[model samples]
Target: MNVCGLDRWLRILVGIILVGLAAAGAIGVWGWIGLIPLLTGLFRWCPLYAIFGFQTCGLAEQKYGS
Candidate 1:
C-alpha cells in the first residue's frame, strides 16, 4: 500500500490512457509501458518506491495495525 490517494489515481488514469492509446494504435508499442503504472496502481506497491524507501500512503501502518 505504498501507493495511495491522488498518486494512485493519477497512475491509473495515465496508465489507462496510455494503454488505450496503444490498443488504438495511436502511441504504438511504447504505450504498452503503461502497464507498469497500471499494475503498480492496482497493487498499491511500487518496486522503485520500495528501493528508494518512498511511501505515499500515510494510513498504511494504521490500516495494517503495524
Candidate 2:
C-alpha cells in the first residue's frame, strides 16, 4: 500500500468531512470529489503515488524493498 499512517488518516478525515458536507448541502457537488481520497485511503493504494513513485508506508518499503 502506498498510503498509510497520518497521510491515510488525513485523507479519510477530509473525505468524510467533504462528503458529509455535501450530503448536508453545505458545499455542493464538488464535495463529491472527496470520494477519490476516501477510496484511496480506504484501499491504501493511490494511483498518483504509483505514477510518481512515492510511498509513505514503511511496511511497503520493507516488504517490497527500495
Candidate 3:
C-alpha cells in the first residue's frame, strides 16, 4: 500500500499541525498542539504508527529493518 519514504498519515498530521501552529494566534491551544504533529513530521517519528501498523517510508524501513 505505502511506498513512499515517509508515512502518509504522519505527513497529513504534520501538515495539520503546521497549519494550526501557523494559526496559533487565533486558534488557541489547538495551535500549540500543532507542535507535536509538526515535530513528528519533521523527524518522521509518528507514535500512531505502532498502533495503526503502518509505515510509509520504505528507504528508512529498509535501512532500519523495522
Off by over 4 Å in 3: 1-24, 59-66
TM-score of 1: 0.89
Clashing pairs in 3: 5-57
lDDT for 63 in candidate 3 is 76
- Could you report the Cα RMSD, in angstroms, for every candidate shown? 2.6, 3.3, 5.1
TM-score of 2: 0.87
Scored against the true structure, residue 66 in model 2 reaches a CA lDDT of 35
Compose the digit string of candidate 1's lDDT tens values, residues 1-54. 688878888999999999999999998999999999999988889999999999
Minimal lDDT window, size 10, model 1: 57-66
- In the range 1-66, model 2's lDDT, one tens digit per residue, is 898888888999999999999999999999999999999988888999999999788975548733
Error of 1 at 15 (Å): 0.3
Clashes of each: 0, 0, 1
Local distance difference test, candidate 1? 0.88
Order of candidate numbers by lDDT, starting with the best: 2, 1, 3
Q: Report the CA-based lDDT of candidate 2 relative to the real structure.
A: 0.89
TM-scores of all predicted structures: 0.89, 0.87, 0.51
